[model samples]
Target: MGRFITVEPGINIFVEDINPAGRKTIFFIHGWPLNHNQFEYQYDVLPAMGYRCVSMDWRGYGNSDKPITGYGFDRLADDLRIVVGALQLKDFTLAGHSTGGAIAIRYMARHQGFGVNKLVLIDAAAPSSVDKQTANEFITATLNDRPNMLHNLTNMFFFQLITGPFANWFMQMGLQAAGYATAAIMATLRDENVYSELQKIVVPTLIVHGVHDKIVPFAKGQETSKLIKGSQLVPFQYSGHGPFWEERERFNQLLIQFVG
Candidate 1:
């Protein structure tokens, strides 16, 4: 856990910066209904390997301020911009997972990735309607019972191991997110189209997808790779939605290699 810095008046963003001032910085944007903890494995391992890891719990998730609104990509990208400027980071890898992937894409497209060196997408939610499980299911489950939905989704799709401790920990992370924010984000993802903007990003990009990812299909990763010029796609054959957790060592090493 690191300090909570106020990026806006009443909106403080929680950031965990590991091995500060290390060789290079990697700013990690976590998945939907999740936060900095989603990259706990990466933050712990990469820093010791001489690469600084910066993970932020988006404004309504984890230890950050949970307001009633501001769940779209425009605000999320600005939040990331402010966080990067606050840390005075430059030439850093901007990585995102799932919904965070969509946010990263928008950031590059809209903000033109001012301080970013490269891009990484992990089990990313696609621009169009590539989510196989469908947003309707998520909306229904969230509206019905968001907490229980996380438990069920975690056990059924999130991980390959599906052990008691791992699933339980993931569920806890998902539950901590603000319900209003989660609901609003889902709706935005459901209606918004990021496909048209992918061509706008010209930075060196990497797409990492678990082959068994049920939530966001591996084909979507392929599609995204096709859309971006000179982008590379890596696969974790044995993992699920979370390769950083399911295949921690390989994921970290691949990231290091990509940035190096």
Candidate 2:
């Protein structure tokens, strides 16, 4: 079960601690349009491996308060700093997925005090201009009707493989529980350039990507791995954008080794 703590006014972050005695703290940041619950597999398994695992819903994405102003990478990084300070987390590992990866890089670049020792980027978007022409083509092709495209784009993270009544129920619950401020903030995040900040990170890093990922692609991960000194890249053969979800066991083992 997760415990709730107020990280800011009108915003309480939900966290679950599996083992307090663990030497290091692992903070998992979820990607866009998904809540902390997306990391349920990690939350369930990592604690037994002797690591204190903590995952929080980003502002507007999970149970946290979603305000219109707190969606940009800068604000999200600040919020992460606040939460780390609140918990007095030190010598911790920061792992982010997609947009969450961008936010983590920004936090490491700007904050000078936190002892973030390791970083893991899962199919993350690098801080470069996503081929504007390609983005436009994708938007045009996928969204024949702009209005309908908007709705689909909003829920693009959820895979169609998850079907039946449960999928419907899950989507309803996720949409209702997520904050409107999240959507507004997400719009601003789509404009961020995180590639420039990569060199500023001095910590040991790991870049994991799905070879078959259609969203972010393998080249982004390869480029990101090259930019960060001493960072290792792990590819999930049959996975797509969400390698952690698609290859949970392998992902967990790799993370454990990296954390050690």
Candidate 3:
């Protein structure tokens, strides 16, 4: 069972156990508009393998307190710092997906003073990819008319595993939980430039991306891996955006091997 922990004044985070007393901790940060529940697959499987896994809901998502403030990378990094401090975690690995990957990179750049051992970025967005006029245009089109694009994006994530009734319910649940304000914050995410910051990250890092991911795209992952000094890029041939869900077993094995 998972428990709620208060990391900030109004933020209550959800944490699931995966070997509470294990030596090494794996702190998983979920993407935008989705909560810790997105990591349910990881939470259930990692613990039995003698690894401690922790996933927290960002402030406005999941069961966390939905404050209208503090939605940027710095603030999100602070939230994560508080959670780590409150838990007194050290020598841990950080794994993030999509927006969470951006946040994790920021956190490592800012807090390398603390002891973060390794990092894992799954289908992550690059810092300057938006600067390319074409990419920026695509982002603008998707954000401007998300409703029309949502179904296709959702389908791309699961490779059409979710469709019809199940897909509708899933999208509805995500929207209802995140709401418009969360979406607005996500829109502002493009402003962050992580390329400059990546040079400072000295931890051993792994970049995982699906070859067919339409959301962040595979090129971003390749570029990110190149930027992060000694980082390794792992490609998922048959998976799309949400490789963690589509290729759960392989993903978990890679995670264990990297963190081990």
TM-score of each: 0.95, 0.84, 0.87
Q: Predictions ranked by lDDT, top down?
A: 1, 3, 2
lDDT of 1 by residue, 40-119 (tens): 78867788889999989988899999988888788888898888888888999999998899989888888888888899
The reply for model 2, stretches above 4 Å from the true place, is 4-8, 129-179
Q: Give per-residue CA lDDT, model 2, range 1-260, as digits (tens).
A: 46666756877766655687788889888775567777777877888778898777777766666665566788788888887877788899999988778878888898952769889998887756345565555345333543343345434433335454644544543563344443444454556668888988889899999887766778889999988888899988867777776688999999999999
Candidate 3 local lDDT, 168-215, one digit each (tens): 755553554445445545555656657888888898999999988877
What TM-score does candidate 3 reach? 0.87
lDDT agreement with native, every candidate: 0.85, 0.73, 0.76
Better of 2 and 3 by TM-score: 3
Q: Considering every candidate listed, which one attains the maximal TM-score?
A: 1
Candidate 3 stretches greater than 4 Å from native: 129-150, 163-169
Taking all chains together, the TM-score of candidate 1 against the true structure is 0.95
Cα deviation at 233, candidate 1, in Å, is 0.8
Question: Which has the better lDDT: candidate 2, or candidate 3?
Answer: 3
Clashing pairs in 3: none
Candidate 1, after superposition: displacement of residue 139 in Å? 2.2
